[model samples]
Target chain A: MITAMSDASAPPVPGFVESTFSPLVHAAVHRCLGVAPPGDGARTAIVLASTVGDATTLDTGSRSLVAGQAHQPLLFMQSTANAILGRLAVDLAVTGPLLSLSTAVPDDVAGELLTTGALLLETGEADRVVLVGVELAAGDRAAAAHRALGTVPPAEDLAVALLLDRDDPVPHLPELPAHPPPAAPPDGYGTLRGLVALAARNQGTPP
Target chain B: MRREVLLTGYGVRTAFGTGAEALRDGVFDGRPAFAPVTRFDTGPYRTDAAATHGPAVPLREVLAETAAAAVRMAGLPAGARADVLVGTAGDFTALTRFWRTRGRDADAGGAAGSDGAGGAGVVETVPAWQAAALADALGVRGTRLAFTSACVASAMAVVHGCLLISSGRADTVLCAGAYLVEEENLAKFGSGFALSRDGAVRPFCADRSGLLLGDGAAAVVLESADGARRRGARPLAALTGWGVAGDAHHVARPHPEGAGLAAAAGRALRGAGLPRVGYVNAHGTATRHNDPAETRGLRAVFGPYADSVPVSSTKSTTGHLLEAAGVVELVITLLALRDGVLPPTAGFTEPDPLCDLDFVPNRPHKADLRAAMTVNAAFGGVNTALVLERT
Candidate 1:
């Protein structure tokens, strides 16, 4: 069962730069984490999903290296999605398993995220899972990947965070992709549309 | 009860060569695969070498071969569809090609992202795309999960594959991963000053400098006991217990106490119902920060028993496989259990007082063993411990 959730537009995340990936994640997670019970962090697992991870940082960092300019090793560090997940784990004091997934499965982004969350509980790894699905607005290089993804690219960075508990498992959570969007502008948001609608439903807010 | 998972076959390719036998022979002999980087000119870099495949083969092709080998060895049917979980940083060879083709222009301060054709070619550089292509190459239509958790990616792949089977989500799971040294990671490791100046990874040594990279590609086929029996497949080993945890500490550096690693190992031992592991294939990157932390984690898990069991890092032989290191080491651990010979740490100069465990060093040591553990820690403070015992 989803206990809490939030969706975020592009927002400045403090201490992170260059790409909106972490910030978008931080914005959504920061809001949802507040709904978590105090001291519940130790049992909370963090799962991050993205099709193409921080290509902006990777592209810029490699370019800097080829040109022999001073490159921020920070770019290399942040390019991997786990870096921010690690930081968030530290910040939130969550000691459960930290994991990330990269896939462009055309359908069922939310279902995939939730299924992984269920697996964490099924494996006795965690009692609660924080699932975040993030996708960046397509750039020229990312556009082709997005086209293959069969989803209309959002014009801006998109992220949604959901907090799932093991008990009261949703039998048809896997069928969420076919459901209509919850009354928002993302009646058509491709990659993260299902996640956004789910979040809205859980939050008791009209999407 | 959860279903039992068995390892029927495995495939590995390193500088030592292809098959698990080749890996065992080379690593047990304390051979080093490190050579000068042959893929490109490393003149401008700090350390211009890693344990590469030498002749230059794409990492994807290597994965394909390893995957097919594991499947063939496991005696799976030609049309058998198995879930593929891989830990990779995508097709860096394509990235290398893109860099090589665009280097002249980009290095001259030309805008890098404007090349549409060049960028499209590298879409396979993403693990998802690479993984999808791998599944297609294997001619199976099944689920594929791509893990990108840095060093421990493939280890997590193995652990989760076990979970998928035990929970009745899958019957046969193909867990595979490979990471060949590339300029992007090399530049990153160099910038971080993590590479050993001497090019030798003397794990747990008092004067240990650091780790080097290598070409590590490996795959293993895991099947439920019932599934294997129905297929009349012989089991090579049993994947008894596994655990994964996060440090909740630093992102790039391990916790000084190896807090997460201890938790993972302890969880694994508990699940395996083995109070003591016969051998431990340590993550042992030979970095100043990693060894001591691993020592603490071992102590935390084993207590006095830590001194009894043998511990060693084959990274001293294979160099570091990065993301691929864990799965390759898992295969190494299996071979050790299969033969009951613990592979040496290879380049141990002297033991650091902080690392007081009995690291089977410099030479292979024979021991009658029941089970062994392979532990891998990644950049995100994520740690995974897998226990494999004889069936």
Candidate 2:
């Protein structure tokens, strides 16, 4: 059961440069926490899912290195994808488990990041799991990667967060919003984006 | 809620060689394998040395070969579909070479390669792409996940494998980690002033300066006890327990006290229903921050027992495999259990008072080690602990 849900559609994060990906992820997670206060940081798990994670940063870092430009440690840091998850762990005081999942196809059963969160609860790994699914508009490298893997890149930068636990019954599958590029889709598109477009598509709906 | 997970087989490749013997000779033999980095020009870096892999092959190729080997070793019947989960930097080396050429082809997908589409044949590399391709190569039918969570990623992959087996989600899982030292990694460490000035990795030593990167790839086949019995596979050891925790302390640095690492080890021991482990395979990056913090972390959990536990860091010889360090170190620990000898902290010169735990310094300690705990801490304040026991 998703106790709280939120989505951030590529909002401009002030002073957050490098790529809009981190900010989008942070925004959705921030909104979800605001609505539903955290119970125990140590008992919570944070899982992030992305097929092509922060491709923008990867492309930029590659071009900079190839072009002989000064190497920015921040770009190198952000390129790992888990770096932000770590920062979030520190910020939210989440010590349970921080996992980042990357799969070629988002439709696979194991690729479902939300189900993983639920599994954590079912398996007694966490009291609650903050599941985040994010994808930024593909850069050249990511476009080629998507073309090769036969995966469709998201229309634009999009992120959705769901806070779920074991006690909640089946969640309400509200009508998911359609992707409108930077426009917050109402609900979800299914597992196509992996947080698989689970019901709460509102930009920032408090449960 | 718990089911037994057995370690059926393992595959490892390092500077030493490709088999269990290689790991024994290269890692457990207390030999330093650090050599000059040939993949990239190391003129701009602090030190020009690391435990580098000499192969010019593609990253996915290495993973595919390694995965196939593990499956064969596990004695899985032909066409046995198993999940492939690996912690890696993907094909960064090939990507860097592509960037060096700055060349493009009209057939973009073809350029990337039919499998990885970019393991040096093309310029694009995705962190998760190789794991999917490896799963396809092995014809495995289970889930594929790529963990890029810095140093602890592979250990976390192992922990996840345990959960999957215990939760009945997977029967046979191929859990592995591989990191080929490339320019980008060296440059990152160089700029941060974190590289070993003398090109020697000396974890827990008073004279220990810093860490050197290494080229390592290792795979462990985890099967549920029932699954292994069904296949008649020999269980080498059992992955009894595992745990993960975040420091929530800092992103770029370790908690001065190793708060997250201690918590993870404690959780793993508690879950394993054990009071103490006979041996400890430490993360021991040998950095100023990590050694003492890791010491405190161990002491925090085991209390006075830490002083008696024979602890060592194979990173002292393997260099740091970054994301691959956890699983590779795990492979070393499994070997130590198999051989009944603890791998030493190879480059130890003198003991640091802060890291006073018995480091098994400079020499392998032969003992009747029953169970060993391997702990790894990553840059993002994430930590993982795995309990492995002789079966």
Candidate 3:
């Protein structure tokens, strides 16, 4: 008895560095977490999926140190994938089992995330689960890294959010945009653009 | 019908080396693995000490070696497919080296996915992709979910694995987690004052300073009891139940009274239908804040059983494995249940009044144990409790 709805194209979040990944994820989650009943957040779960999680912070911090400068603690703080989830828990007041995951393959990653959300509902681990997929859009550094590793580059700045519950009446979102897999497609291409395209296509539809 | 999850086969690659036997003997022998950090230069930090893996190893190789060992030990076919759930804290070395070399001059204000993208030639080391890489390296793939919840990452991964089995999604699931001691971890943890100044791990001791990071990966092959019996596999122990809770108290520090940890333990015990926990493998990080908070958690959940339960913090010997701590400790607990031996908490010289428990200090105790519990708490107030029983 699980129901799910998804959204992408969330506006940029305020009070966070614009170039970083955390704020974008926060904005996407901010819009979707409202679908969850208030005060029921204690039983609600938040699971964030990403391929390149806040690499900007890691880049900045490490570069600074290598340049003989002191590492910024703020960058280190945002380096963990769960940093955004922690803030969302406090802001949204949902405390149940906040988690973050990363994987290379996107097609099965989203499906697995949804399945895990369903399991949480089925096992009574949470009353509802909010699943979010985020991927780093290829920056100059990221693209070069992919080329160095001899892999296709990931799509830039893609994020998708879904709210799931058990046995609830809800409309299914439209399918993600179709794209043939690039030979040796880079990891996390599916969620980066594929998932966002799904949300954009389903924008005018009812859920 | 709800399925019962059983531990069929287990393997570990820790500072002590591969296999559960090596780990058990190392702990019982009271040998601590903490030594000088060798992965990279730690000259600027307070201490250059950690339990490290000596040589450089890629994530795929470690994943392949550990998973293959566990599968072989479980008596499962080498080609058998299983759901893969991995818990990790990212590749700090890869992340740092990539950024330092390729992204050294990355635009400070350029937005990710900006117009200036796709030719920057920077290498990326995202943690999320590790699960998929690991699955491919192991050549066995089912549903995959990677967990990155700090110290409790692997513990929660195990809990998720159990859920998948209980819900009949998969009969066999490989639940594993690993972390290698690296330069970035040492620098970051040291900056946050999370490491011991003296390069020693003394859990529950009066002079305890802080935790020492360790390098290790542990894997447990979990299957439905019926499936294990069908395959003629011996069950090492029953992964009876588990509980997960969040502190919501602070981002870095645990609750003063360990409210969330106690609740987690209570939930696991209730799910297992047990009135008392005979043994506890505590998440005793030997830090000033963690030791006392864990003590409060024990007092709150176990009550009268608190004084009676033989408690030990194996981290005293293994040095904290960080994300892999939960699975490693769980394997230790399973071994203890099977052998009727309570591993000792090494480095205990004087006890603190705040931590008043029967800590099996400095000496392994031979005792019959029917049920045992391993607890793990991470940054961001995440707490997990896993309960296992003798089969």
Candidate 4:
């Protein structure tokens, strides 16, 4: 049985400008783990849940010349649902086994992510696991949707990193949404985007 | 509890050429299938290395053809029953190309429908779809799943398939791994300085620089001892044990101390009920970091036996097949066991001092082997080990 979840964030550390969303999530994980910036010794399994990963990296030339260019679909290579684990590993020099999953429904994605993190803890795979959820709403489709809604953009980038420990205490928070919700179309990135939103909302941060 | 997982049949389509028989013959004759990349213009890519058979054949057709060949090699009846397990790093490269095309044309909807015709909705072609396509071609009716853990994908798929058989979920499981070199992979790895500069792969050698990327597919038919006996199939090898671990270290780079890899190998040996192994088919990518790290890990696990037991990396011939590396290497290990010979590590001239293990060099060595181990570490810090015993 796994039950503890704590979220943390960083104020955009310098010299880590590969991607805005990833570094923010990494900083949050580092803060939650209470280790140095990279935190390789956290002994944690990382599950990267995202809706749109690295969409900002797609070039305009590629987008105009190629159809899925805006999607930066090739960026999928760097964007596993659990890609943060890879990034953290590279940063922290970790070599632990990492697992990633993606689900279309927001509620189902959160539930499954939490359940899987708990399972990993229960199975003795890791004593603590880091769950990083990030979403970047800069893609063409997302921009078009924002324009159609005629609403001011809240935030374009959101990230949340939760440090889950089997023996840690749980924090009191607002009620979480219900599970077994309606299924959404399979986006390239999954519930990771929603996780970022949940994290920002929990922090009382807009976007 | 330990269960005996037998290799009832095996199939391979590789750069050394197609069909299991051809691969076996090439292995026996020291033939390598590596060649210059011709599938696409790799002008911007750093490494020009690949294991392609031809420029005209697409990866999907290659997958279907190899899967059919594997089924034929297994000699399963027309209506045989078996679960399907596929291990892959990514979905079809063709789908990526399709996405690039469809992303350009807003009028073109997403993935093509099941009918192979274009559809209006988003085209979702995942790794499972490829597995389903292979299943449909084989007329197999069983649970199908795709394991995608980068390099260890197919190894885990084989292990999971074995678990299904042991747990009585299916009598036989078809485990296959397929991956093709794409521009994205070439560019990303090249940009990271991951590929070799000389376009040559020299595993465990002092002059070894880095890995050379290649693409290919391999499959094996796994079954319980009872199932194989019932089918009267000649067993190729017995998959005795498997161990999986995550380094929790770095994604691309391995733990400097190789602690996670050591644990995985130890667990695999323990699962196999063996105190030591005869040979180790190493995951020697020949990179500046991997060869030494893997060597240290092997020494840590096998200790005194590390120097005596023959260890070699066949990737010198096939190049690093990435996700498909495990299955291809497993097939080679099985062949080694059957032939009573160890394949040599090609291009290994000067020995790396850090890597002191007995890497059967330039020429193959004939030896009687009872059990062998294959180790693979992937990009996500996922490490896996599979132990096979002579039947």
DockQ of every model listed? Answer: 0.57, 0.51, 0.38, 0.16
Best by TM-score: 1
Better of 1 and 3 by lDDT: 1
For all candidates in order, the CA lDDT equals 0.81, 0.77, 0.74, 0.63
DockQ of model 2 vs. true complex: 0.51
Per-residue accuracy of model 2 over B198-269 as CA lDDT, tens digit each: 989999888888999888888899999999999899999999979898899877788888899999999999
Q: Looking at model 1 chain B, report the run of 10 residues with the lowest lDDT sum.
A: B111-120
TM-score of chain B of each: 0.96, 0.94, 0.93, 0.91
| lDDT digits (tens) for residues A142-202 of candidate 3 | 5554444333444556556777766562233346444435444433454455444445554
DockQ: which is higher, 1 or 4?
Answer: 1
lDDT of 1 by residue, B1-391 (tens): 7899999988899988899778877898888778888787677677976887767667788889999899889998876879888998787666656655577556667766534446546667778776777788888667887888889889978988998998898899999999877777788788778888987789999999888989999999999999999999999999998988888888778888989999999989998998989999999999998999999999989987888989999999999998798899999999999998999999788899999999988899999989999999988688999999999
> For residues A1-207, could you state the per-residue lDDT of candidate 1 as single tens digits?
443433344566555678888877776776677766654666889988777767677767676766766557677678788888888888898888888887767645676787788888887788888888887776655665555444444556777888777774743442343533222234555667667667677657865
Candidate 2 Cα outliers beyond 4 Å, as residue runs: A1-16, A106-111, A170-196, A201-207, B103-124
> What value does the lDDT take at residue B160 in candidate 3?
90
CAPRI class of candidate 4: incorrect
lDDT of 2 by residue, A58-94 (tens): 6676667666666677776676666777777877888
Off by over 4 Å in 3: A1-19, A144-158, A167-173, A180-190, A193-207, B103-124
- Give the lDDT ranking, best first: 1, 2, 3, 4
Please tell me how candidate 2 rates in CAPRI terms.
Answer: medium
